[model samples]
Target: MLGDRFVYVAISTILAFSYYILPQKNEHYPTCPTVEIYRPLNYSENKDILDKIINDETFRNSSLYKMQQAIRINTTSFNDDLPLDVGNNLDKFQHFTKFHNFLKDEFKLVYENLQLNMVNHFGLVYIWEGSNTSMKPLLLMAHQDTSPINLKTLNQWIHEPLSGDYDGKYLYGRGSGDCKNLLIGHLEAIEELIKIGFKPRRTVILSYGFDEEISGFRNENPKFIENIYGPNSMYAIVDEGGVSLMNVGETKLAVVGTAEKGYLDLSISIEKQGGHSSIVDKRTAIGIMGQLIVEIDNNEMPTYFIDKNPTFYQYVCLAENSIDIDTKLKNDIFNSQIDQNANENVRNFINKDKYTAYAIKTSQAIDIINGGEKINALPEYVELMINSRVAVEENITIAYNKFVKDTTNIAERYNLGLNVQMAYSDEIIEVIPATEMGKLTIKPITMLEPSPITPIGDKHWEIFAGSIKHLYEELAYPDSKVVVTPGLGTGNTDTKHYWNLSDHIYRYRPGVLPSVNANSHGVNEYIEFDSHLQIIAFTFEYIQSVDALDD
Candidate 1:
């Protein structure tokens, strides 16, 4: 009887373990949408239409070609004759008027009702409305202006930076990457679509801001939107925020910027009684300022402040696997042994990409510090300029208050007679959830939050994964593990402007990430030739997928 019972128990245990170990089959797990499969449009049959609009040697080399040429002309914000400063209002107007006239003659330019009146700078608004009125409208945005590059540096280019030299692959110029390419891309895409008699189901609108390089704080962009769209009618808006590229591990990831951290400019001032340099005092303004800087450098903003929002955390989890085990363990280390080991192991990871590591952690940078003017003189006042990329979850006021309190405590501890005061601050913007068609949901969230974990069974995930797999065979790296999830962007962009109006914002640029260097705002910013070709094809495929969407 005992032997029989033992055999039955063993059999039962094995059966239960098998059920646990084996994969459970479920029908609800969504598959990629059929539309994602790239089927070449009957271009050969529609050769006449394609040739007339996109391929016509003259039209191609004429309209978009001329516009591309115009983009090559140097238009810096700091030109002595055409400064964008408030005092140079007339010069600014003249520069914009020239572009306005050009756009009017070339494209159908409709003037917006509202005008932006900056202190000395002026802004222009031109719109190109689509023919379809029944469907919702989409806004494609790009800034027209470029930041001023040093005059000395301008002459240092291999070819003139503003010359717009098209070496077949790249159009080398000042605004080439900072965003003339995007502006020109929109125009070329639209012109091509129109020539093919392809009327979009939804209306497409273009918004080009002239004062973006100087920051749009003083501009009346929100008012202009109110006048045109009437409040909440836009379906989606695309601006320069994040781009798709290969990550450090050569993984092709698309960074669709949903939100951006607010920009904060802080000035710390310390005042003290002046004394002779030879007669050194225990407490001086310069000494106090030095102490405060050290305190900020040594300490980090608490990790609890990190918002583990879904969109951000999802990317983090995916990236976590690619990182070195020791680096990963250190970042996540909570115990004493792990913490000690982390300091050594994390150095390699930290050295690889300081900016990315800093994005995962809070950064406090001291840009400017001024105190004593003359040697052998005791400074009566000391000032420090701090720039912080505050996390969205934390309020600027709270962060500022914390800084002040911490500075005060440190001063007291060192017996430094210093008073720390905050000069300026702005609130970090928060991401809100947006609901779309029953199958799709986009949240206008920033990278400050950890990647959000959405159910892998969702149709959107499946479609994205399948599309990537179909287009790029090498997408599944190492062991067929497909990382088809949203990622957090460390850089800031104009994503917040649209996110404020609606939540269905997604930051997606279909291109491989850079492997050699960081491009944006950096020197030698260039996109790969094959990458652009791939993006154009991907755009066609994406549009087809959208058209095939069913209720």
Candidate 2:
């Protein structure tokens, strides 16, 4: 395995040398149906205010200033060894306290008007009580923490990681992209609504978690959803993970993340007997672990399209709208479900692009390993952890079973006792050797099944899609046709914990296609100024649109 700094440098080098190749354009191609919903009431009035807010020099400058201040705070979350209850570890969260003060100072109106509640010390929840109590509230989520910066790569940065430097076009900072920009954007929108005297009839909730980068918030006791809001109480949720606006000739695709991949971290623990360097067994624990790693790496998850998957529908949109794709490939993708040959062809095509390949299949990465104490000793115990982002079409059991099948023969050959939980059954599999020389145990550190797909073509979807279309058409890309299509997030988000809150969950961030190069979770991270402004506009309009829905 590579060191953390080496991995970052390697990725940065690859991206630096990469050429920006434009896709070939074709004028005529098939396209998915565009959503058609009536514009929010008082459309003209709302548009006038939005136009001013986006164009005003003072507002624009102040928005950028707010984002810059946020980026400077440096609220980086880490996966520390200490437990959450430990006060020494809690001291590391001091920056979150500073960030809270900044939010309160910057968005004074919001803090004064909305009801504020803090969860687990760092999680912030604000509610703007609406007139009607019967209607479910709209939930908005963003994380306050950012990924840690590599200390070794400090000098390679174009601007200091926490400087909050704005170089005319891009706002340079660590959290500019993933994602203090989002946290500030939500606050900016809410503050603007208050300025314009716009109060919602349907309640609106804002949630900000301090440790989403390290997946810490997901494990916190007394979940915010259960305490702040009850099950099935929200109309919809909009979070921080979604694809950028993909360009398709004269039109753009607003890819909304309807479902997310599942998560699994399987640790293979091998235990045997230790010995001095000269007296080694047939195979040491480290040697056995290495062989298992190779076996797992060689057998990757297969790529196949499932019609029910949100990714399959995303391709349906592309097959209909994108002219850059080859005609034969488009046809094969369109006919993949019914025709076996075409399905294979489509699968082959998916493998060409790493992004599409991971979307269809479970991703495997050998991230961590530990063994041996002394330099010359044969290790007695070893542990290898394989991380996987399971595809939406599969579950934890299926992924676990695949790993078991891949290494069962190797484990049996070594005369090792196997201990595993039976797939799809409550029974356990415990094979004890008469005189065990070694033992292998496979257990999940964290396991989560794929999220439920949010239903489309319904009223809930209509309002969500309508707001997206309105935002792009009227504010961001007025000249191009904006098409709203279902999408799948390759990575998980905080919304994983809020699954029961709403069936209309959407994880979307309004970013342009070119903005994907913003260097998120990497060196020189930044967000385009125009893209950040668009986010504020979308949030403002989405609240009104959802509030307009009938009881």
Candidate 3:
């Protein structure tokens, strides 16, 4: 009987330990530092002006109607056929030209040649020059291209995919969320501003690239930036990348991305003498290559923290408080204990599925492998392809060299001939925070570092928090924290393009992104109608607050 009691107690303890170690849902996460809140002046308070701006039927109907129309037009613009090429299709060029002409007619925008090179394609840029001649311009950018869908599955859309059905609430179609909305939002915002006779203190330029989906390879973007900003004239630029609404314990937080990780594509090959089916060798080239892949998957890059980028730290800190004791320990190792030794220890404790594990480590996945040509015979050569995300501080070259050396060492142990080479490597951009005085001297102006770390606090953060809270008080999770994240983005988008041009680059999309398998870059992509309205309100409030600055 005593023995049975002992076993029961032991089982209970083990269960408890497992529970403590498991990752908790983010809804139970703790809150980080709160941002300052401000009540925006009621639009009614500035009724005459606000009314003229908001209630302009021509402005509202025309802009929103045009947005809906553009959504329909652009959705059909996607090439459903395989091997989608925007460069080759003359029809695609015509679509862009029509869109360009429409903007020129509606906004009085001058169509000018970027004149990069004769080979470089011609792209359109719209400039809304501000009354204040001294201040550098702000660029509002979005792409016009849509990634082609599979022809067979294209008809599976909730709407015709290209139908652009308003349904009185949500805009259902492709490019609606990915970027078409952004394009419409900018145009509508400008139209509203124009209706109120409100001119920006700084010039606001709207630039659309036709081939952002396939990388702006034609050099249209660089040429456009140079032509407008005169080499180095941009005050700041905003692009699309990181915009997330995360549940932090009882609070819902908004994360704005400031930096992105770099990408590296690598290939490993092992060569050995061909052998007969009957003569099997354990240390064959295929075996060596498989071992190399396993080693990479097992070994993670060193974890480190960027004190300058506070968002990631804030996330870790919140995660620590929200999770159970064992999970908290895991969070601590990732956020604060990123030292070499601590990371090694954490690596042993946690599995690969957790966000903490991915955040602090360089993830390696075997994307492709080629070995034996047939079931009966071993091929002379085996090739392996791997994709790795290097940590921020780790140089791509250093990481690549380390990978090669490590593979070589493993191959030598097996007495196999191995060759490793980098297929392609991209540099990671770091965010650096800066401060600027607002037009209102009393109001502090803050900007993220050219290379900011995650979760850093800034003036724009306060504006975002305040604007969101003011507009969505009912849905407002009080303990919500505003954090600037640099590491959250999975190195997606052409951030590298803008990173080269300006220091004050922020990536955010104002919407309540659904948690359960939100369709982004996938089928049935859609955004809620209320979310769209809220985002627009937030944008208006943000612009107003920033423009009110006096200094």
Candidate 3 achieves a global lDDT of 0.54
Ranking by TM-score: 2, 3, 1
Would you estimate the TM-scores of all the predictions?
Answer: 0.68, 0.88, 0.69
The models' CA-based lDDT, in order, is 0.48, 0.79, 0.54
Q: Give the worst 10-residue stretch by lDDT in candidate 3.
A: 437-446
Candidate 3, residues 1-551, lDDT tens digits: the string is 99999999999998777644664333433344455454444454443433433345554455556666666665333423423333575554566655655655655422331111212343545666666767766665777776666667776776776676776556676677777667666665555555555656766666666666654544366565676567546655666656446554444455556665545656665556776877877656566666776777667566544443333444554454443335645544443443455445544543344544544445566687877887778677676766666555554665666676666556546644432334242332211111121000000011111233323345545554555555454223344444323335444454455555555666666666731234656677676644544444555555556555432
Best by TM-score: 2
lDDT of 1 by residue, 1-551 (tens): 99999999999999776543433223432221222333324434543533343334465445435545655655555423333344535654357566655654555422231122222244444344444555455556676667666666654566565665566555455666666555555655555555455545555555666656655433455456656676555555556645455443544444445445445556666555666788866656677678777888777664321224223333343334344333343233212122445333433344346644443444566788887877877887677777666554555555566566656565566544433333241332211121110011111111222222223334444444345443443321224433444444444545444444434444455445432242444444454333433333333343333333331
Candidate scoring better on TM-score of 1 and 3: 3
* Top-lDDT candidate index: 2
Q: Give the TM-score comparing model 2 with the true structure, all chains together.
A: 0.88
Please provide, for model 2 over 199-292, each residue's C-alpha lDDT reduced to its tens digit, 9 standing for 90 to 100.
8989999888877888754334226656656788898888987776776444467888899999988878888888797988778888888889
How many steric clashes between backbone atoms does each model show?
Answer: 19, 2, 27
C-alpha lDDT of residue 201 in model 2: 89
For candidate 3, the clash count comes to 27
